[model samples]
Target: MLFFSGKGGVGKSTVTAAMALLAAQQGKRVLVVDVDAKGNLTDLFEHEPVGFKPVEVHPGVHVMTMHTEESLQEYLRLNLRVPVLGRIGPLARALDFVATAAPGVKEILTVGKVCWEVRESIEGRADWDVVLVDAAATGHIVAQLGAPEAIRDLVSVGPVRAQTEWMSDLMHDPAVTALNVVTTPEEMPVNETIELVGRVRSELQVPLGAVIVNRVLPELFTHADEETFEAMRDPAAVNRLVDALGGGPDVARGTTAVLDAARMAVSLRRTRAGHLAELRRAVDLPTLFLPYLFVREHGLRVTRMVAEALGEELGL
Candidate 1:
């Protein structure tokens, strides 16, 4: 199982989609589990998520939302077969409160579902090469990853405690799982990634598979070329930079201005790359860098590109 997470809006879903697609294309039976309530992965696949059932999104790729409430209630009713009043009230009210009342209940259920998937496959009931979970952001991810331990400490015996211990063991097992931290080439996200890595290493002691730098701009110039780009700040030298960059005379004055904009874009791209290289130095894990999209929106095409990049990164 491969888990993908980081700060929100950092292209977590896109990365998840890409990896899932790549795995599927490689003929691996893949399940992309969406742990977020928003069902963004469902949206990416152009499906309206119904929250519980696993829906076939693409060939070899299945999607399911980690509806923790239902999972927990079912876990209680069927597994424990108990008659507890507080957690067994009317559906809506019980679910709402259970989701928000206890801190780790929701997180635990989410992890529990993923763990269940892994166990089912290992038991030979289900066959899958990979389960790619697009997990929640940092704080919640930490709690989710730590759920088994939390529950183990709270419950000493019986089925619930056994369940907790089993989940905890699965998470800590390096052979069955690995984590990928995704972030943009910005300061706060990078810092958060650093903190996240520290927490995972120090607390869980699980080795990260990789740190993915998304929306990266490829290195566009040498120091000398950068000096040339800086010289074009004069506007008078813009034409010369354009000539050196090698575009044709058919470029209208409007086109010249566009070329000037391209130079600025290239410079910014270089700046972002430098920041990414700094991040690569900051973390000890293997790094995968994805290029900035030239288009307006991300969809199947962009995701395919990302998957291609991932394949190259993994040497698959």
Candidate 2:
């Protein structure tokens, strides 16, 4: 089970989707759990919004959107042997009310369901080669994942405790479960990712997977190439290049435009390099960088593009 979490807008869903695609390409059966509640991961696969039940979006890939209420329902039915709330009226609503006062109740519902699926896959009841989770944002993932431990602390003995024991067993085993954080090479995202890694190490039993740095701006030039760029930007060289391009009416303006873009690209890359360096210094985890994609839109096409890049990075 691979749980992907990161600061919002750091391409968490995109990275998870890409990994699903990558695993599928490797002929692995992947179950993608969209825990973000946006249900947007299915959109990338061009599928309609899904509920708690898993839906096959692509060949060898299935998706499910987490719904705590439904998760609770499934939990009750499976563990308590309750027949879809037949005995208890509005049990889900009751959970919502109880969740307001109880911290881990709601979180357990989500995380428990995720772990349950993983357990099924691991025990051969379900045929999932990989369970890739598009987990909650960084702000909530710690609480989300640590819910089982919290619940175990609060409830000393019960079916819940029994269930959480096995879940914790799966979580602490590095060979079975891993949590990966996705981030861009930017200030807030990198800071949050570093903080997250620290918190995960201190507070959670889940094993740390690689830090996937997304949207990393590519280095546009080497030292010698940079010197050449500087020389080309010299006014005389610019004038000569304009002359070489026929020096027509808008020749100088076009030359200036291209130079400005190249300058911005180099400047952005340098600034991002500092943040990447900070991440490397602070977080002692395997890091994978995905290049900033220059695209007009996102979908399976872009997802496949990212998957290809990710596959290459994973040496697939």
Candidate 3:
């Protein structure tokens, strides 16, 4: 089981989907679970609305959206062995009220469902070869994954405590679970990723698989290229280039645009390099970099490209 998480807009869902595709390509029976409310994974595959039940999007990839309420109901049915309670309206509403009133209860239900799926089996064989979870943003994912311990502290004995302990075991077991934190090479996101790594290692005790750095800007201008441009920055060279293009306002504007674009690219690359250096210093996990996609929009084609790139990075 792998949980993908990062701050919002860091392309967490996109990376999760790409990894799922790569896993499927490797002949693993993969189930991609979306715990984020946005449900972007559904849109990525152009699938119909996903609910609690798993829907097969590709030949070997199945997708599902995990609703907290539905997960609570399933938990009740499984633990209480009362199927009708899960379907009954009043019982469901009452359980929802309790989940809402209690802190981390809903999180436990959500994450517990994921843990259950990871340990699920048929005839002594695992049901799926792997489970990929597109989890919520950093803060929420921390709270959610920490729910088992929180509830364990609150409820000392009973089924709730027992179940939470079981979930915690599965979560902290290095052989069964791994976490991947995604982030862009930006100030706030990289800082958050660093803090998240510390907490996951210290507080959660979960083994981290990797840090995925997404949407990195390529280094287009080397130091030599910058020096060359700096030498041509004089007014005489500018005028010569403009005159060579007919000396019109459009020519000057086009030249300025090209220079501005190059400058911007260089600035972005430098900033990202600094952030990458910080990540290397602070994070102790394997770091994988994915270049920014220049496509008009992200779709299956782009997803496959990212998956292929990621597979290469992982030597798969």
Return the top candidate by lDDT. Answer: 2
Per-residue accuracy of model 3 over 1-316 as CA lDDT, tens digit each: 8999999999998899899999999998899989986867866766666788898987788998988777876777778876774356786678789877777888898889888888784224556888999987888777888999988887878988888877888889889889899999999899999999998878886678899999988878678988988666677888888898899999999988887788788888888899899999999899999998888976778788889889988998
All candidates' lDDT scores? 0.79, 0.91, 0.85
Which one wins on TM-score? 2
Point out where model 2 deviates above 4 Å: 85-89
Question: What are the RMSD figures for all models against the true structure?
Answer: 3.6, 1.3, 2.0
- What TM-score should be assigned to candidate 1? 0.87
lDDT of 3 at 161: 89
Q: Using lDDT as the measure, what is the rank order of every candidate, best first?
A: 2, 3, 1
Task: Name the TM-score of candidate 3.
Answer: 0.93
What clash pairs does model 1 have?
none
- Per-residue C-alpha lDDT of model 1 across residues 122-172, encoded as one tens digit per residue: 889888779999998876677778777776776668786778877777777
Candidate 2 yields a Cα-based lDDT of 0.91
Model 2 poorest 10 in a row by lDDT? 84-93
> Can you rank all candidates by TM-score, best first?
2, 3, 1
